[model samples]
Target: MTQKAKSRQEIAEEFGISAKTLSRWILKEKLQIPQGLISPKDQELIYEKFGKAISK
Candidate 1:
């Protein structure tokens, strides 16, 4: 089975953050988050670690 790939917009929406802010966080925090071609498992991990910051 194949998995669907997520776009930056989708990821941002999932975390309730703007795409620009998400971009900045990637560079500023040096997050393990991948922009394109990310595996579902890894993306979930990134969200688990970084999604909380979006609320603050």
Candidate 2:
């Protein structure tokens, strides 16, 4: 089965951050993330750099 792609907002939500903050973080870190749905590889890199989102 194919996995559903995740959007920036979804990722930000997962990280407990706002989409704007995620954008800032990406800029600060100089990550080469594309617009729209995030790829699996980029997702992994994001998690690695920022760590997994904390569950409440």
**Can you tell me which runs of candidate 1 are displaced by over 4 Å?**
1-3, 32-35, 52-56
Give the CA lDDT, 0 to 100, for residue 47 in model 1: 69
Q: Summarize candidate 1's per-residue lDDT along 1-56 as a digit string, tens digits.
A: 11566666666776787888768866786767665755667566556667533422
Model 2, residue 30: what's the lDDT?
Answer: 99
Q: Each candidate's root-mean-square deviation in Å? A: 5.0, 2.9
- Candidate 2's residue-wise lDDT over 8-30, tens digit each? 88889988889999989998999
Kindly report which residue stretches of model 2 are placed more than 4 angstroms away from their true locations once superposed: 1-3
lDDT (C-alpha, whole model) for all candidates? 0.65, 0.84
Extract clashing residue pairs from model 1: none
Task: Estimate the overall C-alpha local distance difference test score of candidate 2.
Answer: 0.84
